[model samples]
Target chain A: MSEPLESTLKPGDSYVQSFARGLSVIRAFSAEAPRQTLTEVAKRCGLTRAGARRILLTLETLGYVKADGRLFALTPKILDLGFAYLSSQPLWQFAEPVMQQLAGELKESCSAAVLEGGDIVYVLRVPARKIMSINLGVGSRLPAWCTSMGRVLLAGLPPAELEEQLARVQFHSHTARTARNLDELRTRIAQVRSQGWCLINQELEEGLVSLAAPIVDRNGQTIAALNVGAQVNRTPPEALLEQCLPRLLEAAQSISRLLQIKS
Target chain B: MSEPLESTLKPGDSYVQSFARGLSVIRAFSAEAPRQTLTEVAKRCGLTRAGARRILLTLETLGYVKADGRLFALTPKILDLGFAYLSSQPLWQFAEPVMQQLAGELKESCSAAVLEGGDIVYVLRVPARKIMSINLGVGSRLPAWCTSMGRVLLAGLPPAELEEQLARVQFHSHTARTARNLDELRTRIAQVRSQGWCLINQELEEGLVSLAAPIVDRNGQTIAALNVGAQVNRTPPEALLEQCLPRLLEAAQSISRLLQIKS
Candidate 1:
């Protein structure tokens, strides 16, 4: 498979089927269907009513999901699962104030993310303005090959890992500026590595421009990336690079320094 | 039995054993042990090495965990579990920008949370300052009967549910200021219910002053509580109420309106 590892998880062998199914049940709910009937959830998760019922009832009993005897919706308790991942990561707590200050000062949304598999997951986010059609928040994933933060993070990876990841990537043109091939994508990552930062214009989404820098540790390994996202109309690639890149790189360096001091 | 319902989910009959075990493995990694050896993980998760290894391998296959044959750690893909909960709830998206603006204007941290069982879980946060000793972020839980936001949410609960929750609450004096008895807590909740807002001066933690207002649905149901957290040294009780209460209430009402619009 040319896709990420998430797709390769076997249905029954080596994995816990019930656990995977339970997660599928949770993921079945979205903005369109926050509350669903047992049959609805059953059909979506590809489980029998009895199987779905047990999983739903388990989640409800645990307080992660709620049921009014018929329909089910997630409870706020589910946030704890996400919180566990976040609180375990030491960088976010230290990086939050820095990201917030940068977002505040620059009047742009700032974030930090880590490359995982073939995607970048937002660990920290501070908003100055709403800029995306899709709502992006902490835990939100974006394709690593397209985003500025993704490029910066990819640039940090060892050559062998990077090649393996590139081999698995299924390239698709999200916008006109999206890299159409692995060679082009590698070139972009190379540029980000050489420059110590990256500025991309309308690559991930139309009207979206972003600048990113790697958050390196004392060992000079990039553990994460800091980025500022803006609208293309108000700030072109050159303007984004000139104005936001320095600040983003500075914040990333400061975060690295904080990590160093704490370690 | 005295603990919250979240503690009651067990494997074997009603719940999926593998799913529960998988989540337990995830919960095992915290600030104390973000990275652990397989033996360490198995011991912490109360699993045999073979069992823990299977779950860890399954998680790695599914992109949630990563291993280097000796040590294991969660990747950012784990955030998807939490993000699914968030994106399903429309109130958060509407509440975030408003919370951010209020935090910016008042120069205090603004957050929104909902009561689940005997705990309050944060769903949204806009930090202008860091005032608490323990780091609190989205999905972080605090005792529901102690904090200003918790009291406001408790005040919103039905009488029967409130009593049931109170019965399970392990009330303790975290500081000299925490609620010592249910009677005093009921009085505080009643006051919050009567006045439509609450302000606590160092109740949850020393030097932490917070004001809270309830976000009601169209049917006048208290769905969530919004709060502004400040430090007692910089802002006195009266000063916090005078400067922050109005904006806090305004923001809560605005969030309620947004929920009504979306619903």
Candidate 2:
């Protein structure tokens, strides 16, 4: 759940309170609550009924949201906002074909993500088959501490920044193999940094195994992480490392080269 | 280009000016200008530098926009806004596998889109291979008058709504094959409405042919359109109709059935 509008921030001169409230209203509508009444939106966003009403009306006027009698839902135009980010960043376009090839070669799912705050946000995903209970796609987020892509992305950050991000992580043990503490995570990320790839065995979810490599920019800075994931029953961790790791690294490097040429 | 912020709307009690301006600022950054200085953002958004600055700063503070020295660019967090729409609308989730199967079977790209204004915005896409010069993905927009999916979506609207949308379209002859005027488009849309499907022969772009069918809700009201597109040289219009049409209609009907069952 997003922090309620009231306690999250005090309206400052530079801050647009109405804009913040509008975003809060948008965020309040999730998969769990796809449709909401005015009162539901108001309560969830921590806005006065009138404030939520105005924001919702404004969104309706903009064609981003529509009302079905008493309930409001986002329209497809809401996608243009996200496409702006994807279209602007050329990296994903460069990564997609490479990731698709990797997925095809390995007969698994491949994904690329960039580190954002304490999480990794998927930017590109090419699935050979569905391997996880969670349906992840572009824009889906996962905890950086447990996900293979997340760890590779974290490994790219400067030590001080990495430590800062790690400190902020509200670690949850998703599986028995998840790193137990900050120190353990730090050690894992260090291993990734030195090895140029990271493999996680059922840390994010049971029966899931994934290997990830960094896609670096012209300056050798890791801009994104590429990953391939499979079910453990179908492909054991050792098999994954032996069969997929080399190809995953090659794909990542190919994308990195493209980024360098473009940049 | 979006209308300049100043003349677009009068700020009423229900209209959130800051929120509108924020959206304008976000739209100002596109493929042409992915990164811009504060002055450029202000000029493009038709806002004073201070107004643009505040929004940019607030966006940066919110982690949606990042500053690279003097330039401001959107970060991947902006995708969360788009993902909210995708995640909430169960339609796309239901459409993906069906569209993928259609694309695989037809050996062509299959897509599903919803009509937003005079454009069809892609909601789900499964590409067999890259065929179009323009790289299209989810959230990409194509003019309704020239696209098979767009015509089917337009056919869904009430007569008055369709006319109103048609009047707003800045008709461009993308190719000689595109519908010449409002009357021609109206006839085409009417044909789609009665025939239950639409096929465009290189109307949007030369050598591109596509066939589209409607995805309807429980009420048999068209909610979206699904399409299969291929190069004209590879798949002639007659082949598309005779060979691909039955399968396209079947795939679309399958999705509509799923929607009815779920709804």
Candidate 3:
């Protein structure tokens, strides 16, 4: 596939040839393939090995990648690039306190997540004590349809865009309880919208349940969703709806207020 | 002065071209100027407005930046880029547990930092309880001369390279106690090497004291440094040395062992 538009052009104008290639090499590393040989990178990125070598060498010189013998993997220094983004974005800053207070008050694992294509990516996560079996962290991602956070975000999308996304998604069974068809997904999203929140039971993985509410900005656009997950053994759907939804919406609104002030 | 190498390249290597520019734009947004105008970006990066615009437009399209009317600022989505780096680096994965334990034991803010030019950029930070006045989270950068983390990371450099960094640094005081001469910096780094740790007092900011130790991989290269910080009122230097050094070294060794095992 051709590279996405944002990954290709500056905005309207000039191109710096070598620099773009270097960025492409960094992007090639992902969750499944954390490290890549030069030839592997070349094949994945459609670049020659020598071209990839120049980019890697440049990144290595900049302290972004460490090259041992022949294999190339990213160095922790690359976090500076990501840190540069996070430290500047006001959403995480605004969400931090609200999520912490709500999570502490509720005694559940609370998180704030944003949409990333067909996945929901966790930006802020406050893990509950008593050792939950799931090892979800701040940067972890999961399929949208299988998560409460994802469903809330999807429900906020325009009808046309949501339909297009539903069409594109391959509905795999993450758990027996996961929504596996477009019809079911559409119904669930509609219900979530009507109820002003979503409560998902064992959809992502067995034994886990989550409730999510949309966080809207001044424009009333859902930029993110705030969710709380509990082990189903501890809190069933009834308790979740009655107790968690009110708190979740309150926290989401608090975060949204903070974001508006920041903007 | 010219556009950074990562922001250039052509469409035939489209992945390479776009990735570099995207990375460069992320780099452009720093703590010094979290929000930047197009002209500022162009001038800082040595790009024409036309060149910078294409990259910015691409970034906007990807939902990494929100160009609120005219002023462009990053959105939380950009954290994905940095998270990509941290999630992949095994050193962080290994070091986090030890760092967390050390922080718990000491009741102080502990960080694992690596050197970048004249600054020390934090790759990992386990913050202290009791609420610090300053909100120095992960990814924040501090001057190397005044910070214990920076001194330990600087000790990794060869003597000549160390001297070069000192010469380039404009030693402005963040606090009255900060070092301002090349000789003082040399002496401090040499002392850090000899002692196998660094303890800096109120150099970066008044009342901020930190103890740091170097972390070496199996190759015996100083890949990173670990530090714990608190108010001088909380833990005096004598108590810190007596109580913290042994645990810090133990934590460093644990990280080193993990790095070697993973490698």
Candidate 4:
């Protein structure tokens, strides 16, 4: 598990420690440890057994977690917490039809994600096909330094914040084509910023080729990124750029226009 | 907003009051009130301004909620909380491909939902076309008493629990075809339980016809529901039952088998 970001926060009158810990407990249950015993949950979340027990029971009482004998797991009611975010932002709803159209036209999976810390969290996704070995859904997170959507979102960030985020990344090469160093990544982000779009070729995965464009607000600030992914063998970079990029840009622009009206 | 469920629970040693309150604050933001001021949030969540402010600040610190001047709104990071649920339950992941294929075969919108409180929360949705006036997506909630997926999920519950859930619903007739009273709804639910599938003809919305089957575990427990929806104009009730029912049942059974293997 990644380090608990909450641990860094100094609890004050404004910071609810118990609330933060509850979130930590929720985050502790991941793909690796979906179902865990009390001790396991405590250890993973960096909490005492007593604290974890209280939080777990609280979750159970609220119908967010279910206890199956000795093990505990999150229930579907927990989706309401995520739905709270999706329903609040009408931007995602507006982006969906446009994305669906783009995915149909291009015959590729289309997604929209926003920069969250050092990652991009997919808020909306319309899949034309399963293009990746790793299955990604609405809430899926990918490293911001390696993904097409990531770079587009990163390009939207101010230089100082972008640098800070880059410094925190424990960069490991996913493939030979992935940006190797801080300078290369910065250059790529700079290119995305200049060109107003990004195309990642076999960086995150060997056969994955994706192109991304920014979904901006009224002020032209990029709030989210829109991307389309295909296989390298199926569509070479030339074909992707020539055939798909225009439609991708148009869809992103259309979403941006909708967002502007909504805002 | 519905009555806060946490208010009914007594504050015991195991119950985290601050955590529950924090969740209430999060839930306070919805489709009706996407962004709110401190006073508005406190009023909606039944918290004191100071209490709401602290929780909101804490949420902002965690990157789940963002502050725009005086207004607070949930950020995309909040989806991570929902993602936690989706990532933990491998059922939704396993069910997605099956849903996609079923949607493709039927040329209709396919969905999987689980019973949560008095509602069914959509976990997986694969849309072949925009069939409904309401755009349903993952985390979207619908009344269990009305939706076909809800009826399938409700039928899966033990009789006493099902009765309790039905009693809690604020029953209202959504359409002329909707069951008018408790007895009528009970009869429909009983039929669904006996037949092992459900077909709702324009009960939830006008011109919407939906058929649903339960996705069961190894023990024959309905863990989730799989549904396919189309317009009444495009496909009559007979066609939905004759043509779509077999595919829907096959898909649901296939998912059940996959769940059995995983468990």
Candidate 5:
């Protein structure tokens, strides 16, 4: 019997070269460009037209895409990609109702997020209203250390991993309030851990103030965090902490209990 | 300097092997298994453990995945995969609020959906209450012929493509009410086109009655369908047609106007 020699890869190592390239093609679609011609996709993904055509065609055949004459775009069926993740990811299910409740209670956009390398990937975002200036919708991502959720999640990381993660990214000042020094970031994370909450005042964006609290499982390990954000004019940092923090903490506790109940 | 090769892929083919394999790995994560050990992934993807490991690790490095010890799971960052579709797909933006408002006004779930081959995938689903038996979330797919939205979408499809799609799937009945014959389906679609709407008594599930109207863009081409679903007891078929049809049609018109509005 002959066996296919699957490439040997270490933990966290790269594998399946074609797969990575294919993903690049998919990633080429953005808020600005949802529908693209084959030439645009090829240019975006750095693939030859023939190469892009193959992937797009295969994807179309697989029902992940819908081709409209010369234009190629993803269909709603493509949502199955993320749907598969949300259906399987227990944290999203647990965080959903809590985020919804938090959004209603705070009258602000409340979201649950986890740190992914340099970004805070929003798992669940219960938006408060339409015409949000931030435009950070569910499935949107922002630099982790720059946001309240990122600070809280970073605070929860083990020392070695935390250091490793910090080392990987070149800390640059995004706003005047953003911490540019590693020592300062370390101190900030320590404060966040000790305080059991993190507040980013105009760090990510001026006029966008947010407060966050860590969500820990029964094991006391922080798996996720809840963050509430609003415009600075609508709710100042003082009001956010005073009015929203208690309810946020309660929701976080309830989410923790739910996670434990499932486990 | 050598010019880059243009990627000209046919509808039936793919060019980037790595991209295909990578996407297949991403697709491998589903409702049944969100997280998997390296060995499990290898088995599911038909790759050697080493091959799977590299892909998984690379994904992890890319911030799309996270590994806790031996088990790996997709990160919420993965929603970027679908969010890309939602944010870029211009039709849903116009339809989302209209669908939500219609759901509220009608006191039933309202959705905007497009057809995908033999399936009707929900692009936007506005829920009535927090709890429903069907987790018919956005991006969820159901067999099209059995659904009002599906039927409407099929009615819009060119006859040749419709025939091809019909010939492909085994008309397995989801419920006793499901139409089992291809001829009956064709007739139903034609009637839906002629009548401007489709009503399914309980084709997909018992007691689930739905009324749907086509959502056409300014070009008057059916891009998707707007539908309302409720318990059979809540609204008799005749009443649903009388009461809900106008609202559905009105909402559909509003959405069309919104899509055509200059941003």
Candidate 6:
């Protein structure tokens, strides 16, 4: 009863808890913790040393993880998992050209992200310039509540689900303009929902400004959020909305059509 | 003894075989077949229908695999595994700026790839132009023996290992200039190893010309191969070597230094 739903697997359920634990072990190694000893992996994954060691060895045997006789890190083959998703997504094949054209027209970096927990994971990106301090690749993540993509994604959820998600967020203010609590965040999300888009000014970072629009399916359900980020001085929030919003909305609409067609 | 090494679990072994099979099932779904029925998945993975059903259901429960109540496909959450690897790679973070600069200087698409099985998986890329008909992303793989990056990676391997790998290659005539046999491939790879770079003209595709150099470590091991790909019309092979090879080699050396420093 006390355990998190994330780790619970029923015994008679025909599911392997160890399998899930192995994936959790893989997830434990992040950008911040690129390499770790057995002890650290165990602690981070809430597993015994024996359990973590076994999974690490198995991954090493399969050429997915490499251990330099002591420390364990993921091998390049692990990128195959991300590749499977990118290749399978009819959405990306449809969205890439559209996003490329938008980025070309606006002369800005555009991306497509989905809300996963309290973060937005970039599923597709077309870069015009490297403006942000962070190195954003396809699999990069940013805080969901603060980023324009995050807000647009959150705005898509049902009220109770959104509240439940918001309840889980442990917000530490990133900037002076960052949302302080649930009330402020809820207000921001509501505005995004009403306007069918979102814009953030110096919230994710000092000089970064972004505008995002919702990619909705045939039923008007949001599957993902599309965004274009630019430096504050080069393109203000109002200018972003005035100039890029129409193209962004148009791109999102085409993606939605493609997804529906695939369905 | 009859059991395949891939699926065989040792008695009292701590490694979870089910976890590996679960990933194999996920991998079985690809760009060609994004969704599969339980029977199809079992056939592809060499598992019983009941066994495949169990694993698919487990993934569905964990929110990694989404089912349409009939067919199974991966959800966005499947991306986390890829994100884990991309985030952990200090190499890509270091290589991006280097690749970006090289791409800018040469006006070509620069990439980094590693040898995995008989393929070269792209680990990082910066495109100056869309020269290929196929979409090249962070995880896209091309035949190792045919690509400049692939030859460089194969050249990095030990003599015996390289021979073993080349023996396994099912060499298809990809182009007019494609390597005819293992002896030819070995000769090409040998030259690449001695010269510290490779240039391939119209081997992988029509009009696709590329040059590659090895990104070595402190131990003088080639961890990855860096390359620049241009069109035949815009940049002839000799001109490519004359203009871009120096910068490409310089980029590879700097990336090697960064890896050594990180270690």
Off by over 4 Å in 4: A1-15, A130-134, B1-15, B130-134
Counting clashing residue pairs in each candidate, in order, gives 1, 0, 26, 0, 21, 0
DockQ agreement of candidate 6 with the native complex: 0.44
Local accuracy of candidate 5 as per-residue lDDT tens digits, B38-70:
788889988886667667767876767777767
How well does each candidate superpose onto the true structure, as a TM-score? 0.91, 0.93, 0.83, 0.93, 0.84, 0.90
Residue-by-residue lDDT tens digits, candidate 6, B148-176: 98999888998798878888999888899
For model 6, the superposed segments whose C-alpha errors exceed 4 Å read: A1-15, A130-134, A258-263, B1-16, B129-134
Index of the highest-lDDT prediction:
4
Which is the better candidate, 5 or 6, if ranked by TM-score? 6
**Deviation (Å) of A131 in candidate 4:** 6.5
Query: Which clashing pairs does model 1 show?
Result: A19-B19
**Span of ten consecutive residues with least summed lDDT in model 3 chain A:** A11-20
User: In candidate 4, which residue pairs clash?
Assistant: none
Better of 1 and 5 by lDDT: 1
Clashing pairs in 2: none
DockQ of candidate model 1: 0.47
- Per residue, candidate 3 scores C-alpha lDDT tens digits across A133-176 of 24565666787887999999999998998988798889888889
Q: In terms of lDDT, which candidate is stronger, 3 or 5? A: 5
Residue-wise C-alpha lDDT for candidate 1, range B1-263, written one tens digit per residue: 13233344454543456677788888887878888887898999899977787778787767678876577888888888888889889999889878877987888888889888788898888777433433588898898889888989888888998889888878888789877898888888899999999998787888888999999999998989999888788888999999999889899999999899988
Worst 10 residues of 5 chain B by lDDT: B1-10
Q: For candidate 6, write residues A213-248 as lDDT tens digits.
A: 998888988889999999888898889989988988
